[model samples]
Target chain A: MTDRTPDDLYDALRDRLADYGQEPPAPLWAKIRAQLPPPVAAPQLRRRRRRPIVLLGLLLTVLSAAGWQLWLVSRSGPAVMPAPQTVALGSNAPTNAAVASPASAGPSASPKLGKAALENPGMSGASISETKSSPSTATTDNLRLATQVRPDSAASRRSGPYRPQPAGSVAGPFAGGSQARNPRLAVLSRSARVRYSAGQPSLAVGSTDSSVELPTAAAFSTSGSEQGRLPVDVVVAPSAGGHKAVERSTAPVFGPVAASATDYAPGAPASLLASRPVAVLSPALPQPRVQLRTDTFSTAPAVVRRWTVQVLAGPTLTHQHLGAEPASDPSLPTGIITYLDSIVNEFSRRERMSTGYSAQVQVRRVLTGRWSLSTGLGYQEYASQTTYVASTSTSTPPILSSGVFDMAPPSPHRSTYRFLTVPIRFGYALGQSGGRLRYGLLAGIDAALYLGGNSAGKEAVPTAWSISGSPYRPLSASVSLGLDFRYRLASHLEVLAQPTATYFLNSLPRPLSGLTPHHLFGAGALLGLSYEFR
Target chain B: MPPPIAPVDEALLAACRRGESAAQYQLYQRLAYRLLGVCLRYCPNRAEAEDALQNTFVKIFTRLDQYRGQGPFEAWARRIAVTTALHAVEQHRLRHPTPGTDPDDLAADLPSAEPSALESLAAEDLLALLNTLPPGYRTVLNLYAVEGYSHQEIAELLGIAEGTSKSQLARARRLLESRLATQHYQQLP
Candidate 1:
């Protein structure tokens, strides 16, 4: 044998080699046959199981609603205003000074006064009266009286005799000099002479002696007057056994005025008067005294609206990021992105039914003021229906043990079945701060667990006449591309919706035998609600 | 074609198709030893061979229907097994590209220092020589000299040109021959 070819050498070696005497495991055939999917059952059977579940859900919903209604009814109560510890004057003062003028002077003024007095009782005695005047004698008299009385009241109230000056005496100078005077102007101008009651600060300008409580109060006066004005007095006075006074003065004098004695007792009515010329004034009115520490003045906390729940079902929800870090060494081989896509597709088909009630929780980091990146996990449970066909042949000998054999019968059957699936997916989200709708792309792996179903057991059978089965298998790998739509429900929570299409990288076993490898395409719709701490 | 004799063992195949648990166990037991032999030829060590055998069976059972019957049933199954083994080998190569001394040199050195004579070498010793070749050369040699594949066929199957296939086979043969020559020389000592 002069130079044998490599093929010849190999053939000789092959002939010399020992055989693989091992047989396939005894039960392998049984296991393979069992992989064949079962026949489909009647639709009526599935409907029978679903009806009771639906009815139970409805019943639970109705009962929950009734319980909530009863709870609300039991908790209902009368609405009462909370009383402040220190009711400063002007708590209920009109927001607009101009609007408050006519309203305060009209019939509405009576009820407002009573309510204010009842609510505050500190400034009930302070009477506000309007005046008109001429320019000549009004100046000398108004100035002299305002100057003399203010010192005496200030000194006496600070020292021994706490005599309350008439509201007219104190308001005289500024009110007289002012051309246009509001009725409430007098009460504010003469605020210094309006003595407060013993127990608390209460302005008593007149002899009405009624108790008044000013929750918030302010005074306005003209700067034209040479003499400095007194500080406005805000008071809360006690009343039941109070002295009364009448509204005696309402004169529009344009001449010089006489100085009158200022005497005040607890719970006396407040009043104002003027004898004057043109008093052009600035619009600097005293700010209403408000109880700064009370809850009433506090700002309301931000609220999360329920309608944001709709975002959870919107059409976009997915993320994009590599599962593993890129290879550091360029020389080291890298797999294509298509490989992941194929895996995702196969996985989605294997768990196709797991889309009905998917929920996800995600946490994202703010990359910038306007954008953030998010990654999280999700789970879904869904049901799917599948139909399969199977063929079988049986061999039997003739009834009698004869040489001739009888032909065996061939039988064919078709069946439909349902499967329950649970799929777990991990993905990322790109978010924007002020955008109406947040959007992103997601790429991740999903592992599906066949929960309960007949579909998992299905196996592909070959049409070949070979005694051994085809060699294909069914552990699916897939890659998917999906869109993530995020709807902001509140400050921290968002609704996410994702619609995805995936291509299976590996061919899955067909429900029936003798089929060619076909691409399995799966599309899924997922809705999830998430609350992010970041 | 005489009703195309069933390509697979029907009873065993049926059991697997039915997802029978017992059948799976039986199938694993029956095919494991033979697959293990195939795996051993491609793997550098016993541990790697066992892993390849397990993986091969898994792929075989999972993708059973992909076999289209262009070849013998055994050939198709063996192809799957061999592919699985090669995949494992590729992975190993990726992880440890420079796995110390080249197996060819190691085999030649082993016999050079040993007292054993080449003419008295046992079957096990021959197998050891075959194992000492590098993964690429060993795989080609086995496919060409043991599995009876033509150089052209090996080239197509391995995604290499026919010339590369021939060169690799020649290199593998030269290494083995050198190791045998060293063993023969050491015997003179």
Candidate 2:
């Protein structure tokens, strides 16, 4: 019988098959691609050679500049001297001049004046008058002594003829004849025999030395005594049992006498005693004003302090499906699927030593729930051990032989590894749920900075050695999916668990002697603590 | 006459490759009713036919890469569809025991109808007749008359002897002939 083709049957079946056509789901492609093995590339020797040259140039330039700047700064010692102090005292002397000269001669050489007297000509009853005398010849010893004793009183103002008396005199208006017999003010005037009705003063300085009877509630009284040349004692008695006394002294005054009396309560009137005999003073009298001026200048400048710290450590498991490939070997006929699993145990040990604690300040803007946008600089050190395996087996040895090369099998190889990755992530927080127990999803890109690693100790004899082609290269681009969980401990502190799945897009440098390049699929789960402030 | 190639049909093919949901729905709308007719020739009932059609599409997309550029895309797709339908039939057989009926008696009751008359019949009428056949008979008949597989090829595919395949085809034809003859008589009365 002649061979008859089944053309018609095939055509009929073809006609019927047109009835069913549809597409698969979207996740199918993603899952399938994830299962395939990554492509291998030999590390380019030219690029490798150029990278070190560029890095060396950069290092040299930075070192040179830093060294020069450090040298220059060291050569120039402390930049500025301490400033002088500003002492607020009772004298009318200018701050700079009073700080330069001893206080005894300085304040009294100048005309007695109040704040309004300096600002207006006739307001405070004092005027400026210049004298053409030599600095050494201008003697104001008595006036300076009077100024140091009681600078705020009307009695001190009367010690200088150029000074103006207060509008109300000590014994002028409130001293009535019959009200000057009060027993309370009688102690103020020894020679004046006087009596007050109930609230009046017993003696008045302006009255005659005759016995006077007045109300006991007499509100005004005055008494005076002479020491050497001018009136040394001037006392005013108030019906409230309070009195003011002025005393004159002649000595080189270093500071205000009011400051010398530590028991001079504020807003209280007390008896004032002045040394009367004028005498030459020592040149080395301690100037409390000058000491105060220097103290104010010695203080340090105001500054803000901030401290940020993070620590991370945890165990993690990650599974990455490379992709499906056509069966290259008869032993695995269906196809080869690359699956990567990593069991990582890591510890992030950190210790921060600081003294003299300061407040932590944060200038972060809240972007979403429990998440904030922050622009800051930080330093982190990360290290991890990664175990890697390739799905394909080759009988040929690798072209370059590093220490790791002798360990790979002729069929396929598996190794436990270690490396450091410093990843800086910039992305948005997709969402977060639960308050104390929070979970958030983030998609971002990370830069994996490789340190180095040691290959697994277990070695398999090479069955197939290849010298022409390189195995898969290490991945470089880090497209990551991050899941974060945080438990807030305090207002500014939290403990967090962050699991990240990173897919590297670029290949890594091949270790010279291994079957596979350093390419890897890495995932990490980190349990860390963070401190924040507002 | 050749059917007009609508722009939407091309668009649907492109989108289906990209796994678009809208294109998949459009493809289902255009092909579901027709595929149900094809599925019924191998299925014992309407429910089983619809199930087979659903399974056929799922397999077609999954194995789309197996369809090399050697032949028409439609023809390749049809082979998958038919194979999927036959697999459904085999699965059904494992679940249910065969009925005790004489093949000759069942064949004697088959309907006799002209090819033109069968062609003019509505899809629904053809589907109804196909659903009435037993699972074994319906599967063989669809593979022979509708799908156009030779008895040898059918035997190889179904894992049965060539003689069994020929006998099954003859029995299926006689039953359809008697069913058609009865319909003609009913019309005459």
Chain B TM-score of candidate number 1 = 0.77
> Can you write out model 1's per-residue Cα lDDT over A56-149, one digit (the tens) per residue?
4564456446544543333232222222111111100110001112212233332332222222222322212211122212233332222122
For every candidate in turn, the CA RMSD to the true structure comes to 24.3, 25.4
Docking class of 2: incorrect
* Candidate 2 residue lDDT tens string, B1-189: 222333234455655544455556565555444555566666666556556666555444433323334455555555655655665665566567576687677666355665444544454565566566776677777777666667755654565667888788667667766665666567664
Candidate 2, residue B169: the lDDT equals: 69
Evaluated at residue A417, the lDDT of candidate 1 is 19
Q: For residue A186, what is the lDDT in candidate 2?
A: 18
